[model samples]
Target: MPPLIDHTTHFIAGRWSAPDTATFPDRNPFTDEVVAQVAAGTRQHAQAAIDAAHAAFPAWAAMPPGQRQRLFLAAADIVERRAEDFVRLLAAETGTASGFARFQIRWSVDLLRQAAGWGYRPAGDVLRSDTPGRFAMAVRKPLGVVAGFAPWNGAFCLAWRTVVLPMAFGNTMVLKPSEEAPLSAGLVLAEVLEEAGFPAGTFNVVTHGPGDAGPIADAFFESPHVRSINFTGSSATGRMLAERAGRALKRIVLELGGYNPLLVLDDADLDLAVNTTAFGAFFHQGQICMNTRKVLVDRSIADAFVEKLAAKTRSLPMGDPAAPGTVIGPLINDRALAQVRQRVDEAVALGARVVTGGRANGRVYEPTILVDVPATAPVSCEETFGPVLIVQPVDNPEQAMSEALATPYGLCAGILTRDAQRGLALAERFDCGMVHINGATMAGEPAMPNGGVKDSGWGRSGHYAIEDFTEVRLTTLTQGALQYPV
Candidate 1:
C-alpha cells in the first residue's frame, strides 16, 4: 500500500488554508504513483502570506528571546516524536532512502535545537571609541518580513534555515516550498508551530506547482514588505533572485550549486578513501548541493582507488527508497535522471570508461563510476547532481587543487590525506566554502559556519544565519552636544 500522506492546503496564518488556484499531484519518484494532491499557491497567495508575516513581526520580534527559544525547541520536539511518519513521507515523496530520510529529519531537529541556542546569544558588541565621552555600539535587529524559497530535496533542513531561523531571530517568515515534494514536511512544521503556541501570523507557508515559480518569484521579489529573501536552489535561480532582490535593496542569502571535488592523496588510506568518498557520491543519490562530483586521485593510487570504489558502488542497494538498507534512491524526477545519463554517455563518447553501473530504470539511476575522464569533460565539470562519480588522475597535490579550482562552482570539497599539514594546506587553496579532511563532502556541521563562495553563491550557514536574517544597527552617542564644524 502507498504511504498515507494527505496534506492539500497551505498553512497560512497558523491555519490550514486552501489555495485559490488549482492543485497538483505529488508523485512518488520510484513508483510514479500519486501520493497526494498539493495546493498550488499563486502570487496573490504569497502576498497575503507576506502581509500576515508583516503584521505579526512586531509582536513576534518583541517577544523575549527566552520565550522564542522555548517555543522553537517545543516545535522541534513535536517533530522528533513523530519521526516514523515523517521519514516515510520523506522517502515516498522526495525519493530519499529510509536511512537518509531519517537522517534529514534528525538533522533538521538538531539544527532547530542549535538555532534555539542562538536566541539567547548576544545580539551585538559594544565598542570602545577613540574620542572621549563617546559611547558607541552595534546591535542586531530583525528583518521584518523574510521570504524564503526552499527546494524539494531536504525540505526539512531548508525549511529550518529559511523559516525557522527567522522565527528564532524574532522575525516573521513566509516560506514557499517546491511543489513536487512540499507538503508533508512543511505542513508538519506548521502544525508543530501552532501547537507550540506561536502566533497566527508568525510563520506562513505557500506551496505551488514547480512550473509556477515565476509568479511566486515575482511576488517575493517585488514585494516592498519583504525585507529579505533566502533561497537554496540552482545557480540560475539564485542569480535571478539576487538580481531582482538587489534592485529593491533587499538582503539575499543563497546556497546554490556545487560541483564539489574529493581528492585522494597518494599516501592516503585506500579503505578509508574509497568508503568515505563513495559515501559522498552515492549519498541521497548525489542530490545534495554539497555532493562530491569530481574524484581526483593521485596517479600512485588512482587504479587501486577505482577498483575499490567500483566494488562499493556495485554493492549499493537500488530500488524503493522506503526499504531498509537501501542507499541509492530515485532521482527527484525524470529530468534529473536524464541529466545523470547524459553526463555518463557524453563522458563515454569522449573516451571515459564506466567502471561499474551506468544505466537508469525510470528515475532510479544506478550508482555509476567513470574513469579516465578528462578535466574538461562535462561529467567531471558540470554539476551532475546524481549518483555518478567521475574520477580523474592527478600528478600531485598542486595539480589536484588546480583542477578542482577550474570549476565555476565553489561550494564544498573533500580532501583525503593522512598528512594533517598537507590536508590543511590543500584546503586553504581549494577555493570552496567548506573542506573536510579524510571525510566525505556531504557532512553538514550545524555548529560550524557553512555555505560557499564564487558561483556557489554568497552567505554562510550556522552563526552567519543570524546576520543573514537580522540587520546590524550601530549607534554612537556623546555625553554633551558638540560644536558644528561647518
Candidate 2:
C-alpha cells in the first residue's frame, strides 16, 4: 500500500486502517485545494467493515445500557472539547459557511448526548394480555450489522446522526460516506467512538473516492449479514438501493431528493418572508435536500417579495468559507457547479427572467433569483441543488397551495402568514411530510423528526430514529397453558 495522506484512513474493528484501492485527492470546493487524500474503497473493504460490525454486534448488544450510556457520554465530552476543530474540518471539506459548520457540530454533539440518555428510557411498550397469568410486551432489539450511506450534502450532520442512534441502540454500523465529503466520517465520529472505548468493530467507516460508492453500496445490499440499511442521497440513487434492499430482505431507510416549496402569502411579514425564503433557498449554497426549490407567492405580494429577496440574496457574501461573513460558499464539485449553471440557463431559455446574480465562477455560484419562471419548468420541478431561487406567481391562497403541492417530490413545505389559524390550516394541506408555519423551511433541529414522506425520506429522525435502528421482538410468558386456538 502507498503512503496515506492526512485525513485519509478507514476505521474498522476499532482501529484506523489503510484502504485497499487507489487513493484520490479530496479537494476543497472553494479553492480546489486538496484538503485530504481519500481512499477509493472497494466492495471487499465494505464487506470487511460489515463483517467486523457483525462480529461485534453480539457483545455490543449484550453490554449493559448504562455502560453504553456512560461510554457515549464520554464520547460526547471528547467531541465537545474539540468541537471547533470539527467545525473547521466541516467547512473546509464541504464548502459550508463557518456558522453552519458550527451548527452541524453543535447539533451532532447534542444528538450524541441525546442518544446517550436513551439508555434510561424503555425501547418499547408493555401491553396488556387477554390471557390470565400471562405477560406480553414488545421490545426493540438492535438490528445487527447496519449499512449506512451518508451523502455529500450535510455530511457532517447526517453522517454522525445516522451512526449515533444506531450505535446508541447497540447496533453496529459500517458507514459508506460520500467520496466528496468523507473525512468527517473518520476524523470526527470514528475517532470519538475509538477514544470513548467502544469495543472493536462497534463502529466502522468505508470511504471511496469519487464514483466508487456504487460497488460498495451494491455490496451492502448483497450482504445478508447487513440487517438494516440507512441512506441519504438523491432520489434516483435511493430507488436503486431500495430495490436491492427489497430483494435482499434487509430493512432500509432512504432520505432522498426533494423539491421543497415555500409559500409567501399576501398577509405575510414581507421582511421576514424575504429573509426566511432567501436563507431557505441559498443556505449552504442551496446544497440541502430541503432547500426551497420552488417559491409560490401571492401575485399581489409576489413582486415586492421577489424584489426584496433578490436584494437580500445580493448582500450574502460568497467566497472562501474561512473568511468572516462568507455566507455563501462554493458547491461540492465541478459536477454540481455545472448542473446549476445548466439548469439556470435552461430555465432562462424557457422564458424565465434572471432578476440578479446569475454568474457562476468556477465552483462558486452567486446566490441567484429567477422570476417569471413557469411553474412547470424543469428547474421548477426538479431538485436544483444550487443557490438559485425560482419564483412563481399565484392569484390566491388556493392557487398558491395547489402550486406548492403539485411536485412529485414531497419532502418539506412551508407558509408565511400572520393568521396563525389560517397558517395551520394551509400548512396541513401540504403534501409533504413536514410543514413549516412561518419557520425556515430548510431548518430542522436534532430533537425533531427529520425525515420526510414521498421522495424526501422513508425513515425518520429523533425518537423515530431508534425505532428504525431496531427490530421489534415480542415476548409472551404464560403460566401453564392457555386454551387451545380459537
Candidate 3:
C-alpha cells in the first residue's frame, strides 16, 4: 500500500493551514491501521470555514454561470483522466469493491459534466402580462453560501453531487467530507479544481470528526450569508439538520437512509430476479442506502427463489479488499461491525433464522441471509446498513407490496417479475423514491433525480441536488402596476 499523505491543514480561503488544535487520524479498516492524519477543525476552525465561504459567496455567485460551468467541466475532465487511481484509492480507503468504486468514479464524472450543462439553462420563466402598458418577467438568482455534509459510502459521488454541482450553479460551498473517507475527496478535488482553474475559496474541504461538523452546520443555519444546507446520511441525522435549518429559515436537501425491499411476484423471472436481488442486497456488503434488505417473494415461488439466492450468496468471496476475486470486504469500522452483529443477533433472538451466513470475523461479517424474519425484528424495521438479507413469504403481489411498504422508511426498492404490468404496478404502489422493475436498485444516471420519501428522507439529489442548496429568488420586473393598486 502507498503511504497515505497527511492532510492536517484545513483548506480555507483558497489554501491549507494548520488549525489551532489537535489533529484527527484516519484508519484503514482492512488492516486496522492508522494511515493518515487530518486537521481537526475545531469550533473556531469551523467558524473560520463558514466565514471564508461567507466572504467568497458574493464573488463566486457574481461570476457568469458559463464560467462556473467551464470550471466544473474542466474538473470533470481531470477526474476522468485520473479515474483508475481514484478508483484504487476509493477501494483502499472506503472498503468498497474495486468494481463498484470504478463505477462510482465514472458515474461521478458524468454527473459533474451533466450538472455543468444545467448551469447554462434558463433558471426562471417569463410571466404573462395582465394588460397593456404592463409587462411582467422573472429571473432566477443564485443563493448564497451552501454547507454540504456527505457520508462515507459513495463519498466521492455524494460529496461531488453535494458541492461541485451546486457550485457550478454559482453557489459557494463549505463542504465537510466524511472523516472516514477524507483522502479521496481532498486529494482528487484538489487535483480537479487546480486543473479547472477555479477561484480560490470557491470550494473548500474541511476534515474533522462529527463534533466539528455540528458547529459548521449551526453556523450555516444561523448566518444570513449561508442560504442552504445539503446533507447525505442517516434519516435520524437528516431529520435533525432539517429541523435546525428550518428554524433558521434555510433551504435544505437531504438524501437520507433506506431499508429497501425487493418484491418477487409469482410471475417473476426466478433466475434473473434472484440474481438481481443478490447483488442489490449484497453488493458493497450492503453499505448502500438503496441496497435491498428485505426480499418479499410470492409464497408460490418463495422456496425456490430463497434456495437459489442462498446458494449464490454462500459463494460470495470474503477476503482482502484489494484481491481481484474478493466480493465482500470488512465493515468500515468497529462501530459498523458491532452494529451489524447486534442487528443480526436481535433478529435471530426474535425468531429470524439464519439461512446461510451470519457470523463475523473481526470487521468482516459473512454475507448473511435470514428467513422467517418477524416484521417486528430490528433488521426488519431499521436500516441495517450491512450485508444481511431477510426473506419473507407473501401470499400475493399485494401482500408483498404491503410487507415492503410496512416500514416507514422508503428510499429505494426493486421488483422482479416477468409480468411487465405486475412489475410496473408494484413499482407505482411501492413507497420508495426510486423503484426498479427488471433492474436492480443500483446507481443510475446522475441526471435522474434521486432521493426518498417517508422516514427514508425528503427532497432529492444528483441532478436536482443543486436546487436544494440554492434559493429561487424570482425577480419580477414590471414597468407599472394597475391603476387600482394600493
Candidate 4:
C-alpha cells in the first residue's frame, strides 16, 4: 500500500501551522475511509492568511516580469511531474473518476503555462492624447490581496484557475478551498508553489470544516487588506457572497450554478448528437456546472435521440472512482446523493417518465434519463447537479431556442447539427456566455473567456479573468507646464 499522506496543517506565510481550532478527517466519498487529516481553520487563520498575503503583495507585484514568468513555468513543470499523485489525491479526496482526474491535471498544467505568458503581456495601452504636449496611458495594476473560494467538484483545476491568473498578474492570494476537498483543491497547489520557490506569504491556504465557511468568508469580507474575491460554487451561495461583497465595497468574480442546455436539430447527425448528449449530461456524473441538464431535440428526431441516449447512459459503468473502468463515482457526500434522489423522485411524481436508470445504489445515483417532465418540477427548472438528463421535444429549431432561453441560467449551450451554417445561426441566439456547435456543453480551454450571464453569475474566467483581478489607472505625463484657465 502507498504511504498515507498527512495534511493536518494549514500553509500560512510559507510555513505549516497546526490549526488552532481542530483537525477533521477528510474521507473518501467512495470507500468512507480517511484520506487525510485536514486542519480546521478558524476566522483568525483566515485573517492571518489575508495579512500574510497583504504583506507579500508589494514584493511579488514589483518582482521582474521575467522572474514571475519563470516561477509559473516551474510550477507547471512540478504539476506535470506529480500528475499521478494528483490523480490519486483527486480520487481519494473528491471522488473524481480517472478520466476527469486526468482531464483536471492536463487543464491545470495548461492554465499554469498560460499564466506564465501573462507576465509578458502588455500591462498598459498607449493612448492618443487629446491635449497637445501630453502623453496618456491606461495601466493595469495588481490588486493587493485576492480571496479565492474554490469548490470540490472540479477541485484541482478550478482551484488552480481561481488563484493562478491573479497571482500571475502579480497579486498575492489566500485560497479557502471547499471542506470536502481541502487537500486536492487548495493544499496541493500550495505544495507545488512552495516547491517552485515562491516567496513566503505569496500563496496561502486555509481549510475549514463543513458548515464553518462563514467565519472565513466573514474574515475575507471584513478585512480591509483584501482587494477582491473570486468564488466558484452554488448559485445560492454566490448570491449571498455577492451581496456581502457589495456591502463591503469589494470587487468579486462569481462562477455559479448552471442549467446548461443541449439542442439537437432535425438535421443533426443522430449518432453524434446521441453521443454528445450522453457525454455532456453524464460525464463526471453530471456534477459539472457546464453539464447538459436539459436536451432539446427536434420533434421529428426526438424519439430516436432519446432511445439512443438512454442506451448510452445505461451502458456507463458506475463504481469506485479509482477503478480503471469506472465512469461514474459516488457523490461528494450523502447530502448530494439525497438531493439527486429528491429531485428525480419529485419529477417522476409530477408526470416525468424515466426512460432509463433512476435509482440510487449507495452513494451512486444511476445515470438517469427523463422525458415528459412538467415545467413545475424542481428538476425541470433547477440544477440537479447529478447524472440526470431531461429530454424534451421541440416543435422546431425556433421552439428549441425559445425553450433553451426560458431558463434564468446562461452559462453554456451546445448545438449539434450537420449544417454548420444552421448551427452558427442558432448559436447567435443563445444568451449563454459560451455556445459549442457540433460539440458537448462540457467544454473549456485555458485561453477561452469561460463564464456565464444572467442567474448563472457574471464575470469571466481564463484570459478575461485578468480584468476582474486587477485595476486600471489612467496615467499622463505633460511635456510642458499645464495652462490653467483662471
RMSD of each: 1.6, 2.4, 2.0, 1.2
Off by over 4 Å in 4: 1-6, 19-21
Model 3 lDDT per residue over 81-118, tens place: 88877766776788877877877888888888887777
- Predicted structure with the largest lDDT when compared to the true one: 4
TM-score of each: 0.96, 0.95, 0.95, 0.98
* Tens digits of per-residue lDDT for model 1, 1-486: 654544467877777874455788889888988887778888888888888999898999899878888888887898798788888888888888887777777877887788887878898989999777889999999989988887887776676777776777888988888876676546656767788888898999888886887887788888889898888899988998899887999999989999998999998999999899888988888888988898889999888888888888888899888889888889999888878888888888888998898988778899988888865678877788888888889899888888888888989999898899999888888788899998899878666678988899988778668878888999999987676689
**Candidate 2 lDDT, 313-373, residue by residue in tens:** 8898888887778898888888888899999998888899999889987788999899888
How does each model score on lDDT?
Answer: 0.84, 0.83, 0.78, 0.91
Q: What value does the lDDT take at residue 330 in candidate 3?
A: 81
lDDT of 1 at 276: 92
What's the ranking of the predictions by TM-score, best on top?
4, 1, 2, 3
State the TM-score for model 1.
0.96
Of the candidates numbered 1 and 4, which has the greater TM-score value?
4
| Residue pairs with clashing backbones, model 1 | none
TM-score of 4: 0.98
